[model samples]
Target chain A: MSILVDKDTKLVVAGLTGREGSFHGLNNRRYGTDLVAGVTPSKGGQDVEGVPVFDTVHAAVQEAGANTAMVFVPPPAAADAILEAADAGVELVICITEGIPAHDMLRVYTHLRRDERTRLVGPNCPGILSPGKANVGIIPAHFFSEGNVGLVSRSGTLTYQIGNELAQRGFGNSTIVGIGGDPVVGSSFIDVIAQFESDPETELIVMCGEIGGDEEERTADYIAESVSKPVVAYIAGFTAPPGKTMGHAGAIVSGSKGTAAAKAEALEAKGVRVGRNPTEVADAASEALA
Target chain B: MDLLEYQGKQLFARHGVPIPEGRPAATIEEAVIAADEVGYPVVIKAQVLIGGRGKAGGIKLANDREEAERHAKAIIGMDIHGFTVHQLYVEKASDIAEEYYAAVVFDRGAKQPMVMLSRMGGMEVEEIAEKDPTAIARLHVDPLVGFQAFHGRRLAFESGIAEDVIRPVGTMLERLYEAFVGEDAMLLEVNPLLVTGDREVVALDAKVTLDGNALYRHPETAELRNTGAEDPQERMARERGLTYVKLDGNVGILGNGAGLVMSTLDVVAQAGGRPANFLDAGGGSKAEEISNAVEVILANPKVTGVLFNIFGGITRCDEVANGLITAFGSLDISVPFVVRLDGTNDEEGRRLLADADLPNVHVEKTMLEAASRAVELAGEAPPEDADRPGPSAGADPDADPEQ
Candidate 1:
């Protein structure tokens, strides 16, 4: 019933013995996700949160048939983790680590393109969640309600905030995704939107974009020509001055391009209702679902 | 970080790339001393990060020591592109027989490291690329293949490099790539890569921008951070492990995520208020971090009001509330402050703030209502507790997940 993951999905936690990986692995387990195995180097016999551990993703996959991998490895080792998961033949890989150098991502992205079996979500993102069914990376599951609308965002807390707002509006979500706010990431808006478009359970799409790159503008181009469902969108950083990065490495206004005004204009031209704020965005989505 | 020309040349020289002998000086006396030591006919160049230094008279030829001193006096403390020049680079000038361009930059469209070369090179290279794109020969080197001898040969041949100088130019290209990879540079450009009378290929101008994300591994490169060019709040935030950006407004804004903070700025403006700054306490911010962010924003004299929009995910709303109370203990905050808490542990956070009952602190149930209240209180009108919930307020039973 979700765009990317659901009840059938079996998950493995990479770097499961590390502080972040183990802590969040237990959290996902508590939320009733199918977190069946863990991976850590040279810790093959150890168990975290009662889940069996292996030294390599391939071993975990061979034993548990895990199809998805949630990576919490540090920046230097994150690329290798992603490649190793892909090499192990996982269907989806989500990396939650931040500050991986862009060059490292570039090489990993190059290699991943040649391998057709896997789809990657983020190296600096909060991973995807199918509320009440599966929790992948760190999103608080209790804050959401199960329903038809699909949400994707480039931010962490903002994704939770909007999803919680929709739940508070008596609307439920099919899937909520954080695509990360880095310049180079595993997935893009168009990639996630295309999936949402095909999921029959997803009646509408809610996108949270910010000032940076032409990703949103490029997504607008894709929606104008192909998307049939009503999409409510919000773009952040209108008051942001040119040339200053507003926290995210990718969320910056370079020269005159990638301005919030420019992004809003692009989305509006595509017949999408662009909300001025979070509440306006939720109201727009609610109205469409009605 | 964009290294000034002197720093870039130093990096190039360290990497075995040919560059003119140069020394940086902060005063006219130092410039004259450097020129005397290096001999006459030196070039006095102002050290500034902005472009068009030559057009703005930041670069001048000194035929003698007197001219070097005079140029240094005029160039230092001179303003170009709003940057006040504080240092002068005095170097032994080169006699350029010909000029070409070479660079290694990450091309977004190609998704690879690209080596660019052109016969037409100089300050006008930007114009050349924009107008006649084909004049530049760009090669997107496969990371696996990397910059190779054949790739260097292709650049040399395609850019119309002279037959006698082709090998030297190719060598320079390889060295440039080495410098780019070795320094973890985002951009390495030698505009006007000069061929001298002695047939030596040298970098006439060096400009390198290091990847800030990769600086953790290169602590030596990290020391090259231009503290003089950094904003005080920006430098402080970087040291404190907080993401902060200073804006030209009066409303002090703080939030949990970058996206939420950015949206807060836009909404605050929509509600007839200007946000003074952008401060993201980050996911799961602790009490000390919350107080540190508060101190940072309160330090801005233009702030007439403060807005705290925390959507607790990894960040606990109760911790943010306690942090706010803790901040009041050590600081003097007279302006109106509004806090909106939602997501995990929100009600507990709200209760913590309400029980404390700090003066000039108000909590609204929704993000929009909170922003509206903050803007209202920032002006002459005081916020009323009667407007706790709006018609579309998310706290209604159907919306509340617990119900």
Candidate 2:
């Protein structure tokens, strides 16, 4: 019943021969993800972690019926990898690679819009994981367990930390998706939040956001009008001063509107509980649940 | 990543765009010579990355060589919004009949390349956008179609550009778009594209920002970056491969995770303290990384105190503690340091710090306590080095500790 990915979800690791791809693929298998096949151009016959390798996503999907793809390709080649997976009808494409140029992602995003049926998680993100059912990308498998809440964020490492914090408080997740840290990601907080809202299994949601962009404001507006389920949000970059760009390309507060105060005000106005500390996020969720 | 207007014009000139003849000068003497070469009635613009240079007294018109030298001298050493002006650009001024604006930048919400054109130019475009947003014509260009002739024409017409100048305007827009995409620019602005008395369109001003991440692909653009405009701490951070940006505050922060670092900043503020800078040493940081981070923080005279907030996961807490201990020996850090280490091997992390027996160092259990200590220490003056026990003055107590 998990959204985006589950036990029945067959997965293919794009760029599986690379160090990061191989490492995650091996871990994916170990974590009980249906690691069906691997894709690396010109390495068709090679096998990684006993999973068969193919030359392209199309061939890999054709042979193994893989519906989900976890991409580990570098920045320059990430756009092509996404399009290849989308063209092959892979339902969910999770890109774990960071620093894909914004222009390249804009092209991929345009293509994704026309496709309609395919959904993407990131071009510079840590992938999604449905505890017990599937564990894709790099989130530690033990940090999450099957629960009624959904978690989504623009940060990779933060998502992992938040999930662990929630689990420690005995509040598990239905699914956790890291939408990525790039400014021009394929999907956003609103897209993931919408999916979580629609999922019957997800009774509540935790959204971790950073400074920069109108994504937080846009999501708040969306949640105010459409969402019925309670949302607990923790926005980062509050201590970040105006005009200082942070680590994530997306995490910049250039103007007055993009400041942390502005974002927190917008979210609070939407009736979403906003927590200041990482440890307080679960507590906020608990209060929202009540 | 932000290029000064003069540097951007240099890039535009390379792309065949008609930019006013200009050269950047560091001194009034050089500026006088440049003005002489460009002819009289030149424009002396202070070379800065920030906007609103015109209103900030950064841009001035000089009717003669004497005026040019005077303006250059005044503008070069002036401080506009915390950024000191070190260079002045002397350029041939254009005769203007009409002003137009055009730019190509990534529109995050649209997830596409957005082309913004306006009939109103040479003013704060943001204010115009707020007051009359529709006055600014925005078009999302398909990456496949790109900045084609038709796209440019549509943008020009929508901007209410004159019919006679539409062709040239469209052509210029297309060229600018090409420059934007080709150069991996985050922003390309040609403000006040002047239609002269003779009906010739000329770029009066140029501003461009190249994406730093894409710098690896464009080495030439990378070379154009002026490190003088950046804060010393920011420059140091870039060299160390750490994502650090200096802000005005007293409490200096060092953390492993970006999220944790950000949260720590908020925590500092919420606890009624201001963080001096944001420094993320990255995950799995060793002793040297911590020491380097400490050195950068110490380099800033604004940073009155130091705070180390680490939530160990893949990054072991003991590793950070050892780094802090080692930093005591390497750097003559006179400022107070408040350390908070939690998660993996927490006890060992605390034990390592305790064994170091360093003065002006306090260990706290919670992030709040550590932040409070940092704020408290920042409020007080640093203890005298002669009076305090130096690293060499103490015995190596943890020299033969169990692994």
Candidate 3:
């Protein structure tokens, strides 16, 4: 009943020979994700541990039947790697690489929309994890406990913090998706929330958002009309000063718009309980479960 | 990376967009010389990266050398919205037949670049958006197919652009699009895109914001980063590659990730403490980076206390603890610190902190507890050596006879 990953998922590591790529790729494999192949261009014939390596994603698809891609390439080459995976007809592409130019993602986004073959997750995201079933990106597998609540967030360490809180409260997760903190991510809050709504294993959803864009406000509107499940949400950056980016590329308060208070009010109006802080968010989710 | 007006116009000129003759001057003499060279009836504009400059009296029309010098002298050292102007853009003023607006900006909701045109220009776009939304013609340019002339023509026709100048406006729109994409700009706007008395359409003003992330590709444009106008603390943090934003408060805050740091700021505020700055050491930060962050945070004189909210994912809590210990050894830390360590290697990190027994350091188990402690520490009686404003310090302004 998980949304994206499961036991049947065959994953390929796009930059598997690089420093960060090798580390996270091996980590995902250790977590029992079905990592079948690695792509490193020149050093394609080499293998990391026991996984096979191929120069092209096409070869990985042909030889290893890799249906999913997890990219850890450097920012400059990351978009091209995602495009290559999409062109090879991989069903899903998750990019863990951060700092990709917005223009690069803009072009990639346009192509992916028209191609309609690959579902990209992030150009600057923590990736996804269907707890106890499969792990895809950089999300730590140990914090999550298998349960019925689906969690989606725009941040990484913050997601782990909330996930830890839930686990300590004896609430496990069905899936935790980090949609990224970039302005032009592949998946939006609405996209993942829609998936959670249809997921039978997911009964209550937890959303983590921050100041920046109208994505969270729009998601609140969608939840009011569509979602049947209860959603508890938390938005960071309440005290953030306007016109300054708070680490995340998308986490900025522009003028009077996109404040955390505005976002919280928007969700609360839609029958979604908005938490004042992370602890309160977990508490609200716990109460909804009760 | 919001470019100054002169810089924006320079970029527009590079893309074949017609603009008024202008020169950027850093002094009154330079401005007068530029005004003389550009001919009489010039406009002297304060070169600051803020809005409402026109309303703030930062812009003035000069008919001759005397007027230009006076305007530049009044503007070059003037402050507008906390930003002190150090430069001026002197240019030949235009004779306007009609004013129109054209811009290319990123549409975050639509996930595409949007090109907009409004017949109503010379006024703020926000005002136009509120008064008459339908007066503007907007189109989302698909990056794959790219922006076409047809799109521009359609915008002109829909916005009721003057039929006589529609072709030129369309061409200008296409050129603006080219500049927007070519320069990796987040926004490229031409406010008061003028239709002159001679029927020539030219850009009277330029507002361009280049994407900071894309600067690596354009080194020349990256040089336009003006550090002089930035907050000193923010400039210091930027040099170290740390994500830091200065705020007008007392409690200095540091954390692991953007979200966590932002959350910490809110929690601290809720606990009745205002944050002095926002600093994220970033993921997987090592001991040295943490020590560097501590140095930067403590450097702010307004900070009475600090909070370290570390929720380790890839970042190890012990490394952060080691960083704090290292900072204590190297720096003179006067402010009290509240540390909250959780996740990977939390027990070891806590043990190390306890073993260090730093007098100013306090460890808490939860975020709320840490925030409360930090706020309480900040509200306590100030030390004798604290850099608090006193009668003696405040008397310096009184000593000035100019008042």
Candidate 4:
């Protein structure tokens, strides 16, 4: 079975009245996502695409039975939105908004850690999709189809590329999770890998990561210790020069620890198939599957 | 956005940080006037948005007005790290009994604003921290509580500042933190926060980086943006709603995808030519977007050739090919262009380009071949060295007079 989301997973669009929220919500519904509720303060009782609207996530969850929450709030209010959703007992929260001031996320991250029941995906992510089951964020739905391989990534566009490559190779995906490109995201690579490892339908997993953070190192350690599943990884920022920040806010390797070379070496040492090129990711996965 | 030391100090001075009186001068006359106002023993520093200016001969200590004027004249026209200086900051130099460093920056690990303090000042705190991290004191400030007196006092004590001076240092740190957070600053640094012989601390230098995205909140900060220091092509790209950065290379790249642009650069390098710049025209781009991208690529003097690697799914291949034609027609692009269009309407894309009848343009069947061709065109030697050095004979000064 796919992890985090499936066909029956009921979802609510928080801040759905906003531009990105409304656009993505409509796209999600068009892609057959079970978007049952919409949440927007003062715009309650209104409907977007026939979905019932509620003032707060709590009321929406109670009335519409929505367990998953997708947020498109702006940076300043993003942390509060996530915390409100968590307080309302949303089982899963995916934040698509980027550029939340760093200090704001730290408080939210600490709160999420203390609350063990809630699982959050991103504060600067594209969200996840279990192909043929549900699409949560902005990833093009047609590029993904139901299959045995699971994919997880910290990049939005790279996730799309890997999904497209897999679809072209005739291998569909069980789930594609965008853990987001923020340095302090809701979940880490190791956390998603743990979920993929336990999924029975996920025969092989592809992990897409960028430079910066010790998340890859942690994932390598976890893979070495307990993981037996065939894993293929493609790490970005290899050709990138040292001390330059990339497009992603989280993707900067200033200190000695977060270099692309170091991450690639760590993944390779753990027997995970490491692909250097984005186009070669599918080939590496194909070999891993073989 | 990187701010010059004088600009950063302006913000610091507004936030109540005790800074030496100074003014940025565009000419030696202004420098002399500023030096006269600040009194003798002034320091003349080149106003450039680069680090290590002192080592690059951009900073000089002047004992008098004439010395300050001479130093300003020398520094104003100097180039440091590719940035030419047009202005000099003349400030009252301070006597240093002790030097301490302080900075406020976002810590990714802690996911919060952090203040770093060190007794070892005037030097790069990074090196000092690497050698002995214990010598530096780090405090994570809660956004709600901010940098209170206790936080600053703790840092001051940890950094080994005297107990009596802790209150003043604490006040300074608190104000600096307020400025850092209030200004939406990415980095706020005070290098060589000099402690005078009388035990008074003053900021001798300031460096600040403002978040570009948050500039809308601070109009004053947005006004401080120096467009002259930026590449003309980059400014054009920004005006056209494109993200472009000029690099030292020859092969020009135009792609919709950031990942694709990066891969194109790597492929170009692998194909034996460096990339002139990274320009993302962005997805679902139209004819105008393509023309803008072409303009940016052709603007780079180093770019000898151009490559368009379009993978069309939502972005139709024929549309991109038509855009290329439109761009070529509008701009006088003399550089050779190599294109590889794949996906939707591929044959139609090829047919459209063929119909354009453009010279110096070649369509490739694969990305690899297109990259290779672009590299080859870029590797061609220049027609002539227009700015080459003049020929000089080895004649003795005694014999060469009047001859």
Best by DockQ: 3
Q: Tens-digit lDDT track for model 4 on A20-125? A: 7888888888888889999999888999979988999999989999999999988877888898889999999999887776556767887788788789999777
DockQ score for candidate 4: 0.23
In model 4, state the lDDT of residue B56: 96
Best by lDDT: 3
Against the reference, the lDDT scores of all candidates come to 0.85, 0.82, 0.89, 0.80
For candidate 4, the per-residue lDDT at B207 reads 85
Error of 1 at B223 (Å): 1.0
Query: Considering just chain B, what TM-score does every model have?
Result: 0.87, 0.90, 0.92, 0.89
Off by over 4 Å in 4: A18-20, A73-80, A242-244, A253-258, B130-133, B142-145, B148-150, B162-164, B311-319, B340-370, B380-403
Q: Which stretches of candidate 2 lie over 4 Å from their true place?
A: B63-66, B130-134, B344-348, B354-360, B380-403
**Interface DockQ of candidate 3:** 0.54
**Candidate that scores best on TM-score:** 3
Candidate 3 per-residue C-alpha lDDT over A1-290 given as tens digits, one digit per residue, 9 for 90 to 100 = 79888898899999898888889999998898999999989877899998889999999999999999999998888989999999999999999888888888888888888888789998788989998889998887888978998999999999999889888888999999989988899888898999999999999999999998789988999999999999999999988877788898888766666778778888998889998888888898899999
* Candidate 3, superposed: residue stretches over 4 Å from native: B380-403
Q: Which ten residues in a row have the lowest lDDT in candidate 3 chain B?
A: B391-400
Better of 2 and 3 by DockQ: 3
* Candidate 1 TM-score to native: 0.91
Query: In terms of docking quality, how is candidate 2 classified?
Result: acceptable
